[model samples]
Target: MSGPCSRVDHMPSENPFDDRLRVRATEILRELTGHPEASFRDGQFDAIAALVNDDKRVLVVQRTGWGKSAVYFVAARLIREGYGAERGPTLIISPLLALMRDQVAAAERAGVHAATINSSNATEWDSVLDSLTGGDLDVLLISPERLTNPKFRTNVLDVLLDPSRAGVGMIVVDEAHCISDWGHDFRPDYRRIGALLDGLPADLPVLATTATANTRVVTDVAAQLGDNTMVVRGALSRDSLRLGVAPTASAEHRIGWLTQHLGDFQGSGIVYALTVSAAEDTTRALSEAGWNVASYTGRTDAEDRARLEQSLKDNDIKALVATSALGMGFDKPDLGFVVHLGAPSSAVAYYQQVGRAGRATDNADVLLLPGTEDANIWEYFATASMPDEDEAQAVLSALSEADAPLSVPALEPLVGVKRSRLELLLKTLQVDGAVDRVQGGFISTGVPWSYDAERYAAVAEARRREADAMLEYEAGHRCRMRFLAETLDDPHAHDCGRCDVCAGQWWESGVDDSSTSGARRILSGIGVPVEPRGQWPSGMATIGVPLKGKIPVDERVSAGRAVARFTDLGPGQVLRSFLADGAQDAPVPKNIADWCITVLKEWEWEERPTVVVGMPNTTRPVTCADLSRGLAQIGRMTDAGPLSYTRDPGSPDVNSAYRVQNLHGAFNVDPATAEAVDGQVVLLVDTEIGSRWAMTLAGRELRKAGARAVLPFALALRG
Candidate 1:
């Protein structure tokens, strides 16, 4: 229960390994780093020796870019040669495929034969598996998610567990903090480590390492690691970092600042954002302003991610605008800066991410641009991960009552949980022995499942506390690095005399008027594509909508337009404020209406709309009508008026199937409007686009009544 680095100082001066293995380790390290001067860092030898010589379970909490991978890779190499063992390759349970790719490359460079099995390289899995089991590989890198595979558990893990024939040498769990629910970014797939450990031989010698683990996370991981766990913790402070908080008034100010001053940032680095939307928004704005940047998000393709990561390392790009997806195991030793558009929920998480920069540089700039939505976003993620009692009970009941295992799709509608969330709950329940995932899907274990509401509540409270600590850190009165260090319970948490607070404000918080105006202008110009849904959701028939498969070509609306996406960094923010929750219904502001007109004029459709017809809006009828009338009055087009609702089913936030169902009998064309829209290019206007079904259904009706094309356009859109 002491500080994270409390016992780090107790490591002996003498090397734990004898001269022979020590020398081999140094050789492997040199080869891996491509530097003859590369040597063991502090506590690195102790960790290597503990795993190879002492046969111990070691938990290493070291800073990023501190050669944690070297400890394992070198140890794996030394043991394979120094010891009598000849065959079993070390198995690594890593979280990201990106990390695995990097590790594999490093291993090859180090003359350590390593192969990986992950989702990205499915075509190579069989060959990799053959190499691993055929005693041709030194290290077998596997993703934690793949550990739950029934065949993999039987084929790979079972084969590796044999201590005699193709026996296990060691197991490495990178990003070890994921094993604990108390840790930031806890993953249910990581809990499978405990099960894997239970199945392995006791003396197999396991190593777990992470750059971010506070005292609480350490305790939880140590408990799961079982007895005789030696935590080789190292100091958390990074001397190369010059930290600061910009404390911008809004996301817009942050975007504008980056536009004007990103080139002023020292070198190629990272600009972190809280959400994928935020990252993409920044990427688009910065690129438009001529900053060399690329967006890296969870939704990004793996191939693109690899290319972008290399671009950053080579300094081909000024920065990678990214979410936490870019965190952990990304090694760019000469990275010159790390800027955050929004503060991370936990100081520990922030430190881990910022630590990615300034690792090998003399002085790297680190700045935080805190946002108002940080707390709400933090709370949303924290609460979303916890399995609620009602949801858990529903899942258990559904599985128990079923005669056979139900697939996720079958359980989805039955339990009323989203597919991704449902899978997470199932995994958590599987780990807790409440349910089992078989070949078919999921089935109950017929065991009593206790809902630990208090535990989850405590975790949520801890997350909120972390958020408050982040807010305090951003206030900029205290040394920023020291605040983060202390929040992570670092033993050495004193001021480094390098941050804005310690050396007087080092970052420019104010954005120039010209830059702000330019950013707004560019952002407002970016329009979101409102592509029509070409096919009805499959389950619409079950929902009594009587629609399925590809939508009729004639009934489909043409590609549509929205002035901006709510997730966009520029005009999107302004549009969001106008339609934000609790705002009173009003007409479309003239400024926005003017921009919409600009977008329409700029859109080079094959045929321009000769008429405008508004979707009847229950919540914002005035705004919808105003937008339509404004566009018509400006374009010299005929106003066809609003489409009346025959049956109003107002569940705009439901699933696609239910949304389509709600729209089955929802709209009927007004007699005059129908006549006006018949056999002409019609512009369908709405205040904003949510599900797009309302507009889709209404357009279908108009097209059925013989309109040439229904051009759907909205004032704003959900990103």
Candidate 2:
């Protein structure tokens, strides 16, 4: 949220009046009737001066609210200051039509002669192109897609490459991050930019800039721009903001949560949704809920988007729900919050979306409501259905033959697929390294000999698995902060205990312990029985025996004793625990104990007779005696198995039991079983269940004197 550091703080305090370069620059600006103060200060003047003095090319990058446009505005002014109005024009490649208009408006306001060469300029484009070649215009802004057109490129190449036009003062590549495949808002045409730069002089002083780039993205951008370029990184952190997450079960809950939290804070805010429909729905819902709101998406008309953005700036709307299309070139300082209703596909998208808020350093909040369905949606899109190899090859061949970068509409008929389907196919191809898109059309990367449909399928499956792993992390039993940090590879250790999953309130309250344990018993009963051979005792006695039409239930008539009976109990009635091993003199609950023993008998024969009680909050069912040995074994298994936590609660006696729980749970069960019992408890014994470190540790003290099946207990929720 904080603005850039003041230029005065980074520079010497000598008066500009005495500095010859500064005075001359000011005088030249005054002669040109430009706003010297507006174009200078905040390190802009210094950067521009350095660019002119060294005649060095630079990349000036900024995010949505970082005032990236101002860099060019000042650069153009300084260029005129150094080399009078007769200097050859600076070429600007505008990406979007709307951006062209905005740039032209700003240039007009600053009294600079700038014209855009786009489709919208009917006769005006021709005149401007001619003037640019004739060395008449001061700055020429054209879309990069236009550079691919033979005629357009030829026309501009002549003037810039003429040797008479000073070979272009500086080539600026705006939104340079778009060139990288890893960027969230990638444009195929962006890749062609490197080729465009190739046509320019190697020493043309190119300046490539963008607002956001992680380390990987920055490296990609620098490589795309060629090496030996000066890289300037402004502040990446925005401290005047609070980052929080609001996890919910559904979109409805997300909206509800937003309304509750945003009630008191009233200012411009942007709610970014994954889909256009979601944005519309959220905007409509907020409006109906009495908050003034608007919606923007790629489908929205350019004019409407402009009006809505202007309205937001003018404070005409209190809030706006939009897709990523709305933020690029938008600068609204009073934005109170930026809320994401669903998780973005990647961290880059997240950083960009949240970066919209708190531009002026005032307090702002970034709320992320990553719903349960977000991961599934991301997987669906990330692993979208692809085209057949033949069709893919055909499309690529067609694009290669195209004289210009063809738009979706123009390319759809050639591909013989619906526009939407074709777009996704192209995206998939790009992701798979089969093709590269540059603006409107794509270029084949030449299929690798190793490429195979089965391999692609395998890769998709891997991505899905990774996505599933991330979802599990999101819904895991440990601290949410730790999960996020580990999942995203965040270096800093965070201890926020505020996330819904972290609090464990929902799981604790809604978990049907009875059903969970009951299901486990049923599944274990269906498992193959193990038989033991030798004097080690074939199998321990089980509680029930299969009888006609029903399970013959075994009940204890007295302490450590049992009798066969058939009966049914009411829902809330307490059931007895079935005896698996050890002293028959120990007291155990009659019905529940019988049921546990019955389930165990179904799964065990001679080989390891044991029953597992799936108790909520219970770590693992395995039992181990040696504390240090158990801990060591658990540590090894922890990385290979589903995440398990060791609960110490600080009491020495309790801590020892906790350590056992951690070990017993990690390595005793099959991978599938370990996943199911990840954050829950299991019950088993040593001799009957074997002395496996993990198993023994989990079931240790729980199988002692009066303990029955390591009953994992929880406070029953009261309505």
* Local lDDT at 578 for model 2: 25
Clash tally, candidates in order: 0, 37
TM-score per prediction, in order, is 0.75, 0.55
lDDT tens readout by residue for model 1, 48-107: 877787777888887787788998998888777755344367888888867887899999
Please give, for residues 1-719, the per-residue lDDT of candidate 2 as tens digits: 01122122234334343256566555544434344553343444554554555454555544455555555655665665553223456777766665676777666655567887764343355567777766566677887666555466666756676775555666667777777655555665566677666666555556666766655566667766665554555444455455555445566566655544456555778888877646755665565457788777765544355567788878788777887776655667678877788877655456566666788766776666787778777865664453567666767777778777666667777877755568766765665566665644566667652336785586466455546654554444665444443443333436554444434332111323443343233222221111111111111111121111211111100011111111112211222112222223233334433443443444322233122332212222222122112322422222122213344322111121232333433433334544433443233322122112233233332332222322211111000
The lowest-lDDT stretch of 10 consecutive residues in candidate 2 is: 553-562
Error of 2 at 640 (Å): 73
Of candidate 1, the 10-residue stretch with the lowest lDDT total is: 1-10
Give each model's whole-structure lDDT. 0.82, 0.51
Off by over 4 Å in 1: 1-10, 13-16, 82-87, 518-526, 529-719
Positional deviation of 338 in candidate 1, in angstroms? Answer: 0.7
**Which pairs, if any, clash in model 1?**
none
